[model samples]
Target: MGVVIPLEENKNKHASVKPLVDLTKPGMERVNQLILSKAGSDVQMIPEVANHLISSGGKRLRPMLTLASAALFDYQGDADVKLATSVEFMHTATLLHDDVVDESDLRRGKSTARMIWGNQASVLVGDFLLGQAFRMMVDVGSLEALDVLSTAATVIAEGEVLQLSVAKNMETTEDDYLQVIRAKTAALFAAAAEVGPIVAKADKAGRNALKSYGMNLGLAFQLVDDALDYGGKSADLGKNTGDDFREGKITLPVILSYRRGTPAERAFWREAIEGGKSDDAQLEKAMGLITKYSGLSDTIARAVHYGEMARDALAPLPESDWKAALMEVIDFCIERAN
Candidate 1:
């Protein structure tokens, strides 16, 4: 299973998510209740499928961001809870849909919902979660928050499609891959962080700050995952190591390795990735190529760059346990994985 973020690698014991978890715990309790309530359905299989993934080992960091973002402004209301629940449902829905699309067998070290329930069921449950997410948003009665999340929903779909467009294509550039991640992974993070300030009626600058912070954090988080796919073990990712290669995902490491490779190495990538023939030996070779070309290290460097951007984005926000906790998140995302 993927080691949870804030793993044992944290040398900066001070740099932990404990503060964020503690700060959001009270609010998160309510978010959990909303998640359980909304995930229910008269049809038994719906709840079963939903619960399978929902109870999996995810940290629910996105919704925590919503709670902490609101806490940053000291807003005392329940709307943020509903919004947080919405964010989680959106996240869960995407995971279900993603497993189906990627044909992934494992998630969080458990059998994927698609693996157990079948793709049709996973897709249907994901759609149901999206519907429930919109309902929760409507309950919050914030049009701007609604717009942000709704746009995220649309953008995430676009990102999935964009990823599919570029999948296994060695020609995919860094920009194309970055755009896909911005939409698929970062869009919800941006939405989850922005909605807190919106519901709290914070200043425009604060909302923008959180949004930018989340966007950069999301980028950093995914880049680390990209590097981990090649550089780390299965325990680090929860899924099998080199699943990206098996799935033919043209992530940053692949892009970098492809671009920096010799003509023969490039042909190997074409045969292994674009042609979809990667096996254990080829995966090892690919890892070596990524290392030989500094793809893994450079990917981590990009993650660090974005991590810095995420911290800088929060610099103007009022200092509080909330802000400091959020700052720690930037490092935890990098250090825990690296």
Candidate 2:
């Protein structure tokens, strides 16, 4: 059976999401209603699987960015709500597909939809969500918004393929890993934030600022998640710790540890990571090596660097509560390490 990590325990740690959540409450309420309405279908199974994951515990950060970005420009129309819903559907679809590709048993401390309903169902429902997302995008009638989101979808698919190419390969470079996350994780963030300004008809500078903020924020977010897999509690991570190690998936910490370790240490990594010799004992040894080499700390440092970049991206934007809330988000992302 998969482990269940209760989210309530981490409430204090995740307060960064609170301000944005409160600020976007009205907009998000509309997005939530649309999400449920659009998720329904005659097929029954489609909504079953889609709602299973949708109702599961996720912060819905991407969609909030869309809502908040539009709110920044004081957008009064309902377009932002639809766009926010679209961003969420895109994110949910990606999660379903990702669990299948990773063969993961747990997500947000619950059995994955694939594990419960099977891979075929998960994939098909993910496709359904993607379709619904595009329909919403088209309904908004912004060619530029549609183009940005469609481009992000293409980039996300390419990023998934890129990750598969590098999986279990210890020699994956930092540059290669960065490229993968930039596309797979950050692309939607960029699009979600950029679409806000687009819908509000903001100038190019405003659009570009939000784009930069989302992209850098996403990089920081993923980097911290990678670090958490090695050092965090199951409750904090929403999955068992060392799942990455057991999966033989090479993340930044493993790459750093492998690159910096001694000859015998490198062999150990090769045996454990590439050779798939992961076990409880091997995981313990792996943790030792990671700690000895400061892999986790270094990864956090890199996250801090990107967090700073995200902060800088917002420097030119006029001050507002939404902007302050976004800035707090950057601090929250980096502070999750504590």
Candidate 3:
């Protein structure tokens, strides 16, 4: 079982009540229905898996951005809802494949698709979702939107492969890590926000503004996610702490910790991370070294820096509730413990 913690003790306690766009609002409801319809009837078991994943619940941050961006432009049509669902399908597909690729057993506090259904089934179902997303795109009839989503999917796939290759590759630099993040996580976020303007038929400048907003937000979000694995609880984060290191994935905290440690400390990390499998004593020693070297503080600082960048990206947007909400979301990206 995963570690359990009280929700009331979460780091961002106040954020739990933060305002969000009512996803059940009439237009948003239409979007949810259309998303299910567009997902299509796959082989019986496959569609069931997709549905299970969808219903498992996430913050739906990407689709929420799409809806907020569309509302900002006063989009009257309900096509925005369908488009939002399309973005979600694409996001979900990536998650399914990501679990398989990483050999992950847990996601959102539940057994991962790969753990429950086997790797082959999980991967094949992921492909089915990707195809369904494209069909939804075709229905939208926006060639520009189709192009953007397709390119994002390709980049995300490449990014996943690159991260896998760099696993336990001690020479991996911060720049290399950021590049992987941009491709794997930010590209889709950029596309998610960019689609809103296209659907609303906003002009070039307006569309670019939304794209920038999503890009920076995604960067901040992923950095914090990486940092939390080392410093957070399973009940709060929906996954086990140290799973990244246990799986031989060297993330920002580990990288910085090794870089700042003594030569002997660094060598120990190389054995623990690169050579794989750290005994309890070694893991405890590594955690102490990381704390002494201040790598955890550095990682958190980096997340805050990017969070500021995400907020600044929204300066181009006018003053509105949605704009303020977007800023709050950026803060939540870094401040959230879960």
- Highest TM-score model number: 1
Q: List the residue pairs that clash in candidate 2.
A: none
Model 2's TM-score against the true structure: 0.95
lDDT of each: 0.90, 0.89, 0.78
Candidate number of the best lDDT: 1
TM-scores for every candidate against the unseen true structure = 0.96, 0.95, 0.91
Order the candidates by TM-score, highest first.
Answer: 1, 2, 3
Between candidates 1 and 2, name the one with more favorable TM-score: 1
> Model 2 over residues 1-338: C-alpha lDDT tens digits?
12112343223345477899999998889999999999999998999999999998888999999999988888789999999999999999999999999889999888999998999999999999999999999999999999999999999999999999998888899999999999999999999999999999999999999999999999989998888888888888888899999988889989999999999999999999889999999998998888888888888888878877988999888999999899888878777777
User: Model 1: runs farther than 4 Å from truth?
Assistant: 1-14
Tens-place lDDT digits, model 3, residues 73-119: 77777667777888898899999998887889888898998887888
Considering lDDT, where higher is better, how would the candidates rank from best to worst? 1, 2, 3
Q: Is candidate 1 or candidate 2 better by lDDT?
A: 1
